[model samples]
Target: MGALKTSKRSDLKNCLTKCKLFRTDVTGSRLYNQRA
Candidate 1:
């Protein structure tokens, strides 16, 4: 049970990080497009 909770927490963290990265990438692309 404890192991499953730990795994879930890790997965959540990974998902959050991925979402943040994607947002940053999208923002960067938008900025570059505006500049162009």
Candidate 2:
């Protein structure tokens, strides 16, 4: 039961990190293309 909780927490953290990275990548690309 304890291990399961830890795994779940890790998964949640990973998901959040991926979401943040994707947002940053999208915004960065938009800004880059606008300059051209």
Candidate 3:
């Protein structure tokens, strides 16, 4: 049970990181477009 919980926590962390990266990518593109 402990191992399962740890794995789930790691999965959540990975998902959050992916979401943050995606958001940054979207914002970065918008800024680039405005500058261009």
Candidate 4:
């Protein structure tokens, strides 16, 4: 049970990181487009 909980927490953290990275990429592309 403890292991499962830890795994879930790690998965949630990974998902959050992925979302942040995706947002950054989208904003970066927008900035690049504006510059071009």
| lDDT of each candidate versus the true structure | 1.00, 0.99, 1.00, 1.00
lDDT of 4 by residue, 1-36 (tens): 999999999999999999999999999999999999
C-alpha lDDT (0 to 100) for residue 30 of candidate 1: 100
Runs off by more than 4 Å, candidate 3: none
lDDT of 2 by residue, 1-36 (tens): 999999999999999999999999999999999998
lDDT of 1 by residue, 1-36 (tens): 999999999999999999999999999999999999
Measured against the true structure, the TM-scores of the candidates, in listed sequence, are 0.98, 0.93, 0.92, 0.97
List residue ranges in candidate 2 displaced over 4 A.
Answer: none
Return the TM-score for candidate 4, rounded to 2 decimals. Answer: 0.97
Which whole-number lDDT from 0 to 100 does residue 27 have in model 3?
A: 100
Pairing residues by index, what is the TM-score of model 3? 0.92
Candidate numbers sorted by TM-score from highest down: 1, 4, 2, 3
Model 1 residue pairs with clashes: none
Higher-scoring candidate on lDDT, 2 or 3: 3
Candidate 3's clash total is 0
Model 3, 1-36: lDDT tens per residue? 999999999999999999999999999999999999
For candidate 2, give the lDDT of residue 3: 100
Better of 1 and 3 by TM-score: 1
